[model samples]
Target: MSIDITWGRGDGAASVSTVAELDATLDTISRAHTEHLPYCVTLIAPGRGEFPVMLDICIGHPERSFVYHVAADGSSAWGYQPDLEPGPPFTFDYAGSPTDAWPERTRVTDATARQAARQFLTSGGQRPPALTWETVE
Candidate 1:
């Protein structure tokens, strides 16, 4: 499956198309956090398929930890606290919602996704850090 993975801290974000790259980026972010540097890493991976799958990782706040999966038919399931062993079961919340759901709701293209993520990183009276981005095929 082709997965578009985007990750970054503060205003800087990058995208990788391979699983290995994703792992390396996550490791780097984790190391920085371990050193007590206040940083937030947001990963947005959108899959192309009949039922498009999307995985988002917001690593910083334990309470904000979640995994969202949406099927081809606009059906979706999500879970919280993914860092925990035996992560919570996925819950469905699209029973009677509009046709346009997540990723779609926010316009899931690379440009828009990156913009939204950067916005989130700098929101709430936070300072914008120098941002760097890279794309891999």
Candidate 2:
């Protein structure tokens, strides 16, 4: 069984304001997964001015996944588990009102984000390490 964590920054999205911040976020996630054993973290490089920051985590044993998205506006955060049921895709209208499009993502807090990650891991019979949020510089 393997756990995979992936992260990516948006093109010019302030959600990850600096390269150092991105690296720190990657390090934190990597360290957290180390306790579970045999897990890998992948960082997807972002293009300049990307609109949304993305993070995805997958557990192979029970086969579960969690996806996270932070809007370019920094006004909202989205989390979804795609392995369960079909959900609406996230949308953004760049030409018009960017936030006007979407299936409407649930507003997320730092604690909720951590909780969701922990729950996903635990449901797969994996013990998740303590995870803390790192602010985007």
Which candidate ranks first by lDDT, i.e. highest? 1
Query: Against the correct fold, how does model 1 do in TM-score?
Result: 0.37
Model 2 — TM-score against the truth? 0.27
Question: Hey, what RMSD does candidate 1 come out at?
Answer: 15.6
Q: Each candidate: what lDDT?
A: 0.36, 0.33
lDDT of 2 by residue, 42-113 (tens): 222242234432343322212222334333344333354322343234322221223221232323323333
Candidate 1 residue pairs in clash (backbone atoms < 3 Å): 12-131, 51-72
* Count of clashing residue pairs in every prediction: 2, 5
**lDDT digits (tens) for residues 7-106 of candidate 1:** 3323345665554555565566555554342232334334335654443433432222333334444555433221233322222112222122232122
For candidate 2, what is the lDDT? 0.33
Candidate 2: list runs displaced more than 4 Å: 9-103, 125-137
The superposed Cα distance between candidate 2 and the true structure at residue 48, in angstroms, equals 36
